[model samples]
Target: MHVVVIGSGIAGATCAESLAVAWRNQPEHRITLLSASPMLKTVANFHQLSRTLETFEIVERWLDDALQYPNLSIVHATVASVDTRAKSVLDTAGRRHAYDKLCVCAGARPNLIATAHPEHVIGIRDTESVKDLQARLGSARRVVVVGNGGIALELVHEVQFCDVVWAVRDEHIGTSFFDAGAATFFMSDVKLESAGMSENESTATLRHGLPEEPEETENGVAIFTPHTLQQRAAKAALASARAGVSDIPSSQAPPEPNQTAPAMEVYSGAALGPRWQDQARLHPIGERIDTPRRVVELSTSVSAVLSPAEFVAYRQQHPAIVHNDTDILDWPAIVVLSNNRVYGCDVVVSATGVVPCADFIGPEILRASDGGIAVNDQMQTNLPDVFAAGDVCTVQWPTSSHWFQLRLWTQARQMGAYAARCIQAAAKHELALLDFCFEAFAHVTRFFGFKVVLLGLYNAQGLAVGDYEVLLRVTRGHEYIKLVLANGCVQGAVLIGETDLEETFENLILNQLDVSAFKDMLLDPDVDVEDYFD
Candidate 1:
């Protein structure tokens, strides 16, 4: 049996590893890992940078370490297309590699800012884009950030020294991660609420703390603090830098300097650590005054990205809020919003989500509207002998109540390992059960310096309002815990800070235990909830 796995992302790499191990003793079986980027990013710990909403980063690189298996080979090539009829894969170099089974795990791309000067925009998706962002931020004094998802959240919290004009299309912050209630909790921190500010008549919440960037202060003098995740990842990358990078990038690139973009441009795009935020300030008013912290602007969307000339014309039609006569302004580009607001900043960041790159093969491929190849429960695509996993393929199977697709690394790893088993089963004509990882959605991450564990239906996601009753606990900047119960059974929960209720609550959700009589006391401050359950 021969298997071909496309893209060396977490999905492809995991699948390749699983396959190589399974076929180690089978002399007739072969596995090939094809990648566009130079090295595979192995992610272990998952957390957003500085806990404002940034996502994750890498641990270490096993750089061609898969090659230790004689039957498994790593190929550096850009996939041109899949010839379903011939059961073969073609590369940009016109090379053809045939396969008995093929898995497409090409991930998603970043949806960049729509602007005329692609040169002035950056979408921080991969390590490459982030490095680009860090180098540029060193010289930037003001930045215009667009989007309300994970990326935007991280930036609003961590980008120090510069003024950020954060624009979103929602009524509250973090539309992608939190509801208005949870947003309220985080909003308090964003506004720098007093440690004694009265939280909701409900749950208490605690915040986490500082590390370092080995960063320079406002005076351009570098300072060192405690070791940060960024520092550790940098050291690891340097220690195991891949010998050579492939010519093709995993996604699109920013236009080179001096290039003239004729029109507004866009493309799909494509992590963090701590003290990461101390030096950085989140001043929306663009001033360093001692007044009240700025309220985060919401429900506004960028209408246009303008050059200096366009900005002047725009200011003529709709005057600037605070006029300046300086011949040279702080920003080269001006972002105009739907609310008729204008922001001038050094660079614009587009955190707008992603669309899968399922078309790396062709249109004949079965794909979801979001551009991910559609696969059945067995992880097999429409084409025979072809399967896909990870962000590149959307699972079309009937899912369990605890599971839903969220385009996360967790799902990618799960799908990849499952796909490998599916391949083995198909080759042997054997039956395989879906991995239990799909039975429930369990994720462990740290946000705002608190351990965040999300388990099955964490937000009562698909249930109608008022259908469930909520139990609450709060300790004023120490902890906030809410449990959703329906028909006396635990449905979901939102745990902030160290509540120590996750494992027991998860068990309740999975076991579907009735706790109606004890519901009111589930979150009681003095109750030993775990003991009661045990």
Candidate 2:
């Protein structure tokens, strides 16, 4: 039996490796790995410089060990399409490779914003782009970043040369992974502000001439009038740009240098259009909206009022109106925009998100549904004999009601292993379908500064909501502990600014233990739960 695996990312590599192990003693199965680029390279290379560099070396070692398996083969080619009916893949060179089973692990590509100029935008997806960004930043005194995710935050911290402005459409940064309070704290430290602004509060507002009213039912969050937040964000960006030009203190200043110079500013705004609240929950850190003076609570309804339709349409109707014109486009000598053209800048880096590149899997083999490939629990595509994992396949997380695809590397690796097992099982006599139910859990543990960790599913319902216990402590700083429990069983937890019992907490989550006996210990910080395991 021959199994074909596409892609060379974490998921693909893990799946192939797992299958090779499964067939190690059998020696009857043959594995073929194909990729568009060299194997083991970082996926988009947007990670830390050290991590990106190490990925290449790690992948090379992985491949070397895998090649030792006599039945495995590796091919370097771009897959053109897959014909599920024929059980074959066609490469760019028109060479067709047949397989008994195929796993489509083709990952995603960077999603670029339409407003960005392609020539000025550089995506940090490869080594070349990183080099280009470093070179561009060497001379840049001002830089504008358009996204507000982890990558954007990391970039802002790493690139110290110039004035940095982050243009975000969301009310807050890290909305998905953090709670509102946490988001506010992060923004406070980072010094971010929301874009857009409003006029007199008494006046009736109209976004694209549609009468606007506060949305009260959802979250009761404060709403920024249309254009108000964006305007404020734009102004902040302009201030940073202006500061970049004038704030450089002369070399001959006081012996004790003046420490009151204004710092580089970052402006954030939510994209206009229908707001995706659910998407916000998926972020590893929760989200927040930033104002010039302070972080603010934004009403969910505010998004409905400031929909992207009106914003984009308004810009379309009034071409002369632009945000942060003085800083971004229309500044006199420092910056200039002529007919929507920018003259300055060595390079523009695009830190936009990514989208699955599943087009290579022919339409017949894997039909697109709702912008993602529909897949069964076994990770099999709609067509027979073709399986998919990673960003390409849309698999529902067992815990969350959301049916979106799991794009994280962790999920991809697990799905790949499961898919390989299913394929191998299918090759033999009829076997019982494995239980598709797998808990969707995510957690993070921060060490050194504050030991912070989050586990299990916080977004889902019907599991354990109020039944869980929580402990809040205020000592030197603050410590928060939350646990999820169902029928006295410890499901998951979140611990912040504390690590005395982290190992015990992690084991409880991993083992899915019934903590009924130790229910009283949940509140006691001194209790050593690790002893219970022993």
Candidate 3:
């Protein structure tokens, strides 16, 4: 039995590792891992200034174990297409590899604004893009940032030398991550002259390219390091525990060894670590003396990105237009917002979002929300003996009422491991049960220097116009908790700060417990919500 996996991202790499380990003793079962990039990424110790702006160093230690496994070989090449009928995959190099099973985890690419100039605009989706932005930011006095998600939020905090004009389509900041109330909580940080204390500036030299050649052991294990801002926080609970802090924010306890799988490695384009903002030097934009500390333009988006020629043409038509302190011809890109406003900036950061990069598998036949390939609960795609996972695939299975897809790393890791199990079961002609992870949705992330925990339909996602009641508890700059209940049952929750209610709330949503009688006391500071549920 031969299993071939395409793309060395977290999902693909994880699936490869899982399948190799599962079939390790079965030498007849051959597993081949194909990577487009030269190396893989590991979740390292992550530091944060705001929730999304983070930093970390890469580790090559993971490959030592990966290569030691028997009957597993790693290939470095980009897959071009899959001939399902022929049961084979052809790489860009024209080398054909036959497989009994194949998993596509090509991940995604930047979904930039349609009007943004290709050269003047850059999307921060991977390491290369970050380097490009860093190189461009060197002399930039001002920049226009478009997007409302993690990348945009981080950039708002990290830009010290440049004035930022943040334009969002939403009414509040971080609409992608936080609710209006929490968004307001973060807005305060935006008003501060500078966030996170600056330790004398430490220079970060971007690695030129891929690291040293893969070192091979006698056992045939190959090891190498990745060069990128590609980041996913690895140790939070452990970090807090190791630091001897008992107040586990968001009730996030580190998963036991048995529950944790090999960390997903990725090439992550334009991705930044948790500390991308806090660690940056907070140099104000001296060129723009009048620019405020921070400006958040809500309910707006970049309507157009014009080149110097286009801006010149546009200015001729609208002679009375107000302008920022920039020469329209000198700027790389000029942005026009929906409010008929034009601003010239050194460059534009299109941190909008991403779309699946499944073109390698031919025109996508199976589709899901957010341009991901739709897959059943078994992680099986419409193609026979072929599967998909990670950001490239979407869950089409009838999910638990408490769970919804969000295309996050946690889901990627789970789906990868689960996809492997489903593959194994199909290979052996046996039944495969869905992993328990699908039973509920639980996520722990940090934003604006607060531990943010999301459980179930945290933001009332996909909920129609229904009688959804909310319970709120807030303390300025300390913590915020909100619970959403539809009818009389616990449906979702948002936990910020050291609420320590993550576990209890997860159970409430998963178990569908009716908290109608106790709703008022759910967030009572003196009431032990866990004990009450217990």
Candidate 4:
């Protein structure tokens, strides 16, 4: 049996390694790993520059360890296309390789938005591009970043020297990861807000009158409104009208002076002025605002309602009142543009996220649907002897009718292993389809900062309100712990500034153990949760 795997990304590499292991005892099988760039050189480049450099290095080491198997052969060549009917792959060099089974894990390319300039974009699709971006950033002073994805924000942090201005259409940053309130606070700290005034209708109102003789300020530009400007205008207008009136005789005289129009009330409050307003309007959504005594406790939720009409209404109803203005002109700057162009910069990098690069397989073999390849639960496409995993294929989980897209490294690795197992089972007479379950799991542990792990679907339906439990503890400036429990087992947990027993917590989640007996103890800070696992 000859098996061919296309692409050498994490998914493709995992599939090849799994097949080699499965066929290790079977002498009849031969496995070939094909990639456009061989020698694993690209992996090294990614390790040197990307945010997950260490993670990439670990993965490379794993791949190298897997290559010790005798049945595996690594081929360096670009795959031009695949023929499902003939079960063959054509390389760019015009050489054809036949296979009994094919695993398509070509990974993805950079998904550049139409508004972005492709020339100025830097992405993680390849190692060469990352290296080039590193070189460019060495001298860049101002960078305009576009997008609200994790990579976009990560780039903002990674490029320390270059001022980053992240452009986003959304009202807040990290919408996918944080709830609106948390996101609001997070964005506030990072100075992530909407850029340039959202249309005129979206601009806030000014309740007060404009001041005469603009006050000159040192910083940027400031617009000031005098405290009594509105009152003075109203009085002058009333006096002028009264004098001009050849009063239509005593009888018609405007119902006496008692019926005079009510005086206009001018509001006096500090406001975000015109220049600052313009800055707010034009600035990107994910740029950080560094201030003295950064406060992290303030939390505000992003409103569930997000529509252009709603935005317009909010602005019309709540115009910003200008009380005072200050200059931010001296502050470090990052310029963001819709198009790809470099003005003055120390670094120019692209935050283009990954996209499906299934060009290796002909359209006849795997048709594209909704910007992705359609696949069944077995990760099998319509084409025979062909399968795909990771970002390329979609799967329907038993929990929901909606098909989920797997893009994470862990998911891709699992899918690749499953595909290899399915293929191996098919080759043998005794093959049983394995029942696989897909659950959405997202976990975050910010080193010494905070740890948050979510399992299953927190926001999904079908969950009984009382079926879940939440445990929270704040140990006075030292530690904060939170846990979400379901059916007496650990569903999720959030830990801040402490992880003494994280492994034990993780084990409880994975094993789905009954914690009913220790429910009280688990809530106690003095109690050791690890002993319960024993």
Please give, for residues 1-534, the per-residue lDDT of candidate 3 as tens digits.
999988666677778888888988898899888877665543456343222122334332233344556778888777778888899999879999999998988777665666535677777765567767877777777688877777677787777566677766654456555565566556544453211112211000011111123332212222111111011011222322332223212211112111111122233331233444454444542353455444454445666789879887887887755555455677777887754557778778877666777766765358875568889988899888889998888788888887777666656666778899999999989758987778777767677667888777776676664356555666768887777778677788888898878778877887787777767677777777789888
Q: What C-alpha lDDT values do all the predictions have?
A: 0.63, 0.47, 0.65, 0.46
Sorting all predicted structures by lDDT, with the top scorer first, yields 3, 1, 2, 4
TM-score of each: 0.78, 0.62, 0.78, 0.60
Candidate with the greatest lDDT versus the true structure: 3
User: How many Å off is the CA of 210 in candidate 2?
Assistant: 34
Q: What C-alpha lDDT does candidate 3 achieve relative to the native structure? A: 0.65
Better of 2 and 3 by lDDT: 3
- Cα lDDT of candidate 4 equals 0.46
Error of 2 at 494 (Å): 3.5
Decreasing TM-score order of the candidates: 3, 1, 2, 4
lDDT of 1 at 292: 24
Query: Which digits, one per residue and each the tens of the lDDT, describe model 4 over residues 190-295?
Result: 4322322232311110101122243432122221222232343343334223322111111100112211111221111111111111122222234333431111
TM-score of 4: 0.60
Lowest lDDT 10-residue stretch of candidate 2: 265-274
Taking the tens digit of each residue's C-alpha lDDT, what string does model 1 give over 1-534? 889998777788778888888889998999988777666655455553211122344443545653467888888787878898899999878999999999988887666666677778887566567666776676666677777766667776666456566765654455545444455566545643211124431112212111124342322222222233235334323321221111121111222122222232322222222222332333333443233222244445666778878777777787633322254244687777665656666688877666576555777888876568999999998898999998778888899886778776667777888999999999988756988777767665555555655666766677665566545555546666656677778877767787777778877887889987766567766678888888
